[model samples]
Target: MKPAVDAIVHAFETLDPEHIDTLEALYAPNARFKDPFNDVRGWPAIAAIFRHMDVSLVQSRFVITERIVDGRQCFLTWEFHFSFKRFSVGQPQCILGGSHLVLDEGGRITLHRDYWDAAEELYEKLPLVGSLMRWLKRRANS
Candidate 1:
């Protein structure tokens, strides 16, 4: 439980639209953040992405299942639990993923990259695309 990793876990665990202001202390001023759907630099851009998430999802939270740290770099495996505003209401969804983070000497994140499968975790759960995506997966596997 390094200081940087602790900060990240705490920040994500308690994150929400209102609490997003707390990110400034966790990430560097010019930090870069990237995921399957976004690639952005600087805290403002990063915060914007999170704000979009707050608006789009009905509810969302992250559970860090495992963490490995070495020097200033760390890898975390997590489960993102969420419900889409436009889709399921009471039903919850989960995406299993990992993140790679690089921190500065001050323990503020300098780079954050997330890894996850869009097809399996997202598209395959959709109403129309789900069928096609499942078919494609079956074809690929068979």
Candidate 2:
């Protein structure tokens, strides 16, 4: 079971979009998924999110730094690299994040929650709009 999680993590880190096909075997049919921008229900929705990621980010990769599992739950810390359509041609930027996953009786993920600082990792990576966003955040917080 642990090895299955490792394989999934590896697939994610490697940014292999083809892995989504195996998700039906790894996640429950009604799995719940949550991230900074989306709160989705069911495996199909989760699969769509992965598909969107593959299409939007060129050469996207995930690198799992840490993983801990207790019973049916696992926590993973990871770093991701990818090139956006507008950023630096083909150069990838790194984004650090983590995920908490709860497995079902069959050792398939039933719930998955991703955590990341979007402002620092994504918003700051934007071009001209990034500076303005930073300024507005600073001013608004002050």
Candidate 3:
């Protein structure tokens, strides 16, 4: 499982639209992927999500920071770095998150779930919605 996990880490670090197709090789046909905004199955749907991200953002990339593996499952911590294509300034933004992945005997991922705060990690970064989100967060805290 080390080799399989290693390959997945490497693939994510170098993932791009041009090599989007390569991701299918790492996931099962009916694999499940769920994140803050999407819950999808199958490699094609998963690939579409990645493709959409590439189209919507500029210079997006993942930087894996840590991982914990046990048997056929693992948890990974990463930072997603990118700049918005339409919204506001061109400052680099980073979303801190983690993922839980379960692999099959063949080393293909069967389940992938990403954990992150939409309000803090994404919505709060927008130019307009950012202020609103921050206010809401403050209200919730106080």
Candidate 4:
């Protein structure tokens, strides 16, 4: 289980469009994956989401800073670094998030759910919506 967890972390850190085909090897055939914007089932669908990320974003990478493995489940805290092609061209952005992953006995992820703040991590980084989101956040805090 530990080795599988380590392999997953390594795979995520070096993941790219070229290696997108390898996603099926890391998850079960009917794996369920969900994030802020997508809820998809099956390895094919999961691979599609990653494929979209590779094509849509300027650069995307993940760093797994922490992990806790308990039995067949592992919780990982990661920082996703990326730049949107149309928005922040050369400026790198980061999203602090975590994932809850449940693995089968064979060490293949059966369920993956990512947790992140869409308002702060994504919407607030946009061009027009950024200003509005920031303003609203300031007002709410005040």
Candidate 5:
């Protein structure tokens, strides 16, 4: 059997908010989720994270570049694009990043980790701090 995890991966690749409904069918009642800005438990909380993303982000889209599955875990390499609201010392801008996911026994995600170059993708999108951030990243990488 291909397992429900495959279908879950497909749903994310499609980038449709409605697809989240499929999660209810796939996840355990007490699934846990963790990401850059969120560390939440249960299906409702995880759904809220998606809900927030749907409402707060403008033109947000996720494109899965690769997927690897081992037993109950599925690691997804993805690229995301979204507009961010400018904060006190930042400019409204677009950002990009990758995600990694770990599924549970029922094929529900138990852990979600996001990996991205914050300086290049986020800090560079800032206002006054952008230049300094870019310089620091360049210096650190080189």
Candidate 6:
């Protein structure tokens, strides 16, 4: 399973539009994927999400910081780095998150669920919405 997970990590770290198809080999055909923004089944649907990411952002990559494997389940902590193609921040941004993956007997991922704070990691980084989101967060905290 380490090899499989390693392959997945390598693929994500070096992912690009041209090599997107290679990821299919790492997941089951009907594998399910869920994140803060999306929940979908099947390899094609999962691939679409990556495709959208490539189209919407630049210099995006995932760095897996830690991994815990127990039986057929694995939990990975990662940092997603990217720069918005639409907004020139002049510097990169990063989102801290984790993923819980369940693998089948063949080591193909059966379920891939990502956990992250959308409001903090994504929404609060936006240009116009950043201030509003921060204000709302402060209000909520108060």
Steric overlap count per candidate? 0, 1, 0, 0, 0, 0
Enumerate residue pairs that collide in model 5. none
Candidate 2 residue runs with Cα over 4 Å from true position: 137-142
Ranking by lDDT: 3, 4, 6, 1, 2, 5
Error of 6 at 53 (Å): 0.4
Q: lDDT, candidate 4, residue 59? A: 78
Model 4 global lDDT (CA atoms, 0 to 1): 0.93
Residue-level lDDT for 67 in candidate 4: 99
**lDDT per residue (tens digit) for residues 1-119 in model 4:** 99999999999999887888876898998999999999999988898898889776967999999999999999999999999888868789999999999999999999999999999
lDDT per residue as tens, model 1, 1-142: 3977897887897787788889888889999999999999999999999889888786799899999999999999999989888766657999999999999999999999999998899998777888999999999999
Between the candidate structures 5 and 6, which one is better when assessed by TM-score? 6
* Backbone clashes (count) for model 4: 0
- Could you give candidate 5's per-residue lDDT for residues 39-103 as a string of tens digits? 78788888888878766565566777777777766677777766654343222354455556666
Q: In model 4, which regions exceed 4 Å deviation?
A: none
Best by lDDT: 3
Candidate 1 lDDT score relative to the true structure: 0.89
Q: Tell me the tens digit of each residue's lDDT in model 3 across 1-142.
A: 9999999999999998899999899999999999999999999899999999988898899999999999999999999999999985588999999999999999999999999999889999998899999999899999
Model 6 lDDT tens row, 1-66: 888788778887888778899999889889999998899999989999999998889888899999
Q: What is the TM-score of each candidate against the true structure?
A: 0.94, 0.88, 0.97, 0.97, 0.72, 0.94
Task: For model 1, state the Cα shift of residue 31 in Å.
Answer: 0.7
Q: Candidate 6: which stretches are off by over 4 Å?
A: none
- Supply candidate 1's per-residue lDDT for 104: 93
Give the distance in Å from residue 132's predicted Cα in candidate 3 to where it truly belongs: 0.5
lDDT score, residue 41, model 1? 95
